[model samples]
Target: MTPPRNVHARAALLMLGSTLGFGLMAIFIRLASKDIPTWEVAFFRNAFGFLSLLPMLALPALRQPRPAAAFAASVRTDQLPRYVIRTAIGIASMFCGFWAIAHLPLAQAISLAYSSPIFVTIAAILMLGERVRARRWTAVALGFVGVLVIVRPWSHAFSLGSLVAVAAAVLSALVAIQIKQLSQTDKADTIVFWTYALWVPMSLLPSLFVWRWPAGIEWLWLAATGLMGTVGQLLWTRALKLGDVSALTPISFMQLPVVTLAGWLLFGESVDGATLLGAGIILGSTFYIAHREAKLAREQRSKAPSEAVEPGS
Candidate 1:
């Protein structure tokens, strides 16, 4: 077995890889947006992303002998409703996110999107009836403060694109909650496969209304966006599989700097002080929440055997 430290190192590296892939995906999305409608970009992103998975789906058959079983295992007919809802919400999230990225500075858009964890906490309380202790509540409060700082309402800095980005974050949080629920009954691969399968059609519906042919280089950018997204998801899943989520969670913040640099170099975008401050506050709160959850999980595991033992052994 791998040592715990090595496992953590590997997970961290995988997370870095995931962040880089996602950052590049954002860059490509921005690039494609220059020549195509946001809806068209969304459609091609999902379509090509689904196509990218075809080789991986077939690889199991090439290595082993059971092609039919490999293909069948990827689909879960019983979970159609859940998959549909997830994809529907995901399509909305992508449309809003693509539009936001296309209009706003890349780093600003990314920081705003990272606010999903804050919304996820709120969703758990309202939807799942999950109890929030005082510290978590405080963290949630500070997270919102961070968001306000970034948005800076009543200021010239805020725009419709900023609100759209926040909406995307909320939608993304809803999808995250749905994925958590689905995880109780579905294998990770099955969930991923269904996302692409359902998303391809749902995302296409919006594109149909605003269709435009990609002009030469736009096609390449669109393909890169799709490929990057798929690779990023795979790397993120592998990182979680390899190590503790709490330990790996912070590594994702690496994307902020990566995207910031990409935006500066590629698009002449600069990060302002307020945006940096807000991102720091938001990330700090989320990190605290993650740490607390990990600590509580550890405490529960430590007590499990004692609680399970008979009163008088």
Candidate 2:
């Protein structure tokens, strides 16, 4: 469904804010992961985030569970099976992504995951039956090439962490496709809430095998990480709801620059020439994809009949 113009403007701003918050959260996660185990960090992040939302969820408007099968409804209820599937995929993606950030350079982790959009485009075509036009296909191809540049697999031995980040991107793409499918049958809040609600237990399983208590300061950082993540997710969902995905997506690329700067200032990491070049390519391709999507949306709207009547026909 087409959103109003005001929604588009708000979504764009919110998406930009979400990316910035996300980039900062990555930095904090990396810092906290230094002294704490990855699983512990992940657990705390989700647990604290869930606790933080208690007040919001308590509100009468958001209290009831969202039901599936009514795409536009403000409230909804169970589609337990779909939530289970999406939450599982999302948990894996988050687990691997957090682990990757803890182990790899922050910029590298962020850059690698940026490939998710390319994966999303492919999934949309293959699984969702979205048409693959020539320009979009070209953009998809270019985006992957940019990822290859960043990975540079042929030049050096690939790290397991790098592979994990790539896997995270693939899983994230699948989850996103699931969201798209669910959007056809469910309200946005229902899908978002269910994914998080179910993920808590699933994420706890692996952490249980290796869980350890964090120190006082570590707990604070972990709590902060969760807060940032929760806020970021809220901003992200709100953004997409306000505008076309294509219009809001390009703003997400801002995350790379934000993370890169954070890594430099906070961690003393340098941005190599290769990384910069690869980032440029990825950004360019993503911009093209966003432009194409917005163009397509506009074209569709233009072809629809106007509500206005002709003068005294």
Candidate 3:
């Protein structure tokens, strides 16, 4: 058996690999956007992602005693409503995110999207009725301040792309909350498989209005984006299975720097001083929030065994 320490190290590395895959996906999105419309790009992304996941779905079927039943079980019909809602939200988020990536600097678009964790925290309070203590509230406040710093609303620095990116973050938070609820009754694979299955058709509708077949290397980038996205999702899930979420959460921030470096090297995009400062502040708040949540989870787990014992015993 693998040592606990080794498991953690492997998880951390998987998380890093996941981040790298995401960074590459962003780059490919940018590259493909040059020739393809954002709507079409979104469609291809979901379509190709769904196609790439077929092998995963098929592999399970081959190993099961009842292949047909196993295949059907992978997509639970009872959960279709929730999956539809989740996929709709995810499609909207993807459309907005792709548009922002097409219009804004890679770093700026990614930085704005990073605000999803803050939105998720707020959503948990309002939608899920989860209580937030003062420290987390403080972190939320700092996160908003960081957003203002990056956006500079009163100045000319603000643009529609920034607003769209923030909208995407909000939608993404909603998706995250939905996933939290779904995880209670469904497996992760079911959730992912259904989302991609549903998303392909939903994304295709809007894409028809803007449809233009990709030519030349455009096909390569679009396919790469989908493949990278699917691979990244797999890595992220594996990482969570192997390590504590808190240990992996901080590692995700590594994507911003990786993207920033890619932006500089590939596109000659330079991040402004204020943008960098704001990103740092936002990341710091997110890190704190994740750390606090992890600490609380650890405490709860530690107490569970003791609480289970009889008082007399």
Provide TM-scores for the models: 0.93, 0.86, 0.94
- Residue by residue across 181-299, what tens digits does model 1's lDDT show? 88888878788888998888888887888898888889999999999999999999999888767787788898889888989999999999989999998888888777766667666
- Model 2 scores a C-alpha lDDT of 0.79
TM-score of 2: 0.86
- Clashing pairs for model 2 are 65-76, 66-76, 66-77, 67-76, 67-77
* Ranking of models by TM-score: 3, 1, 2
Off by over 4 Å in 3: 1-3, 305-313
Error of 2 at 8 (Å): 6.1
Model 2: per-residue Cα lDDT at residue 305: 70
Could you tell me the TM-score of candidate 3? 0.94
The numbered model that scores best in TM-score is 3
Reference-based lDDT, residue 159, model 1 = 76
Model 3 residue 12 CA deviation (Å) reads 0.9
lDDT of 3 by residue, 30-113 (tens): 999997999999999888888998888779788999988888877675788888889999999999999988889888889888
Query: Distance from true position, residue 118, model 3, in Å?
Result: 0.4
RMSD of each: 3.6, 5.9, 3.5
Which is the leading candidate under lDDT? 3
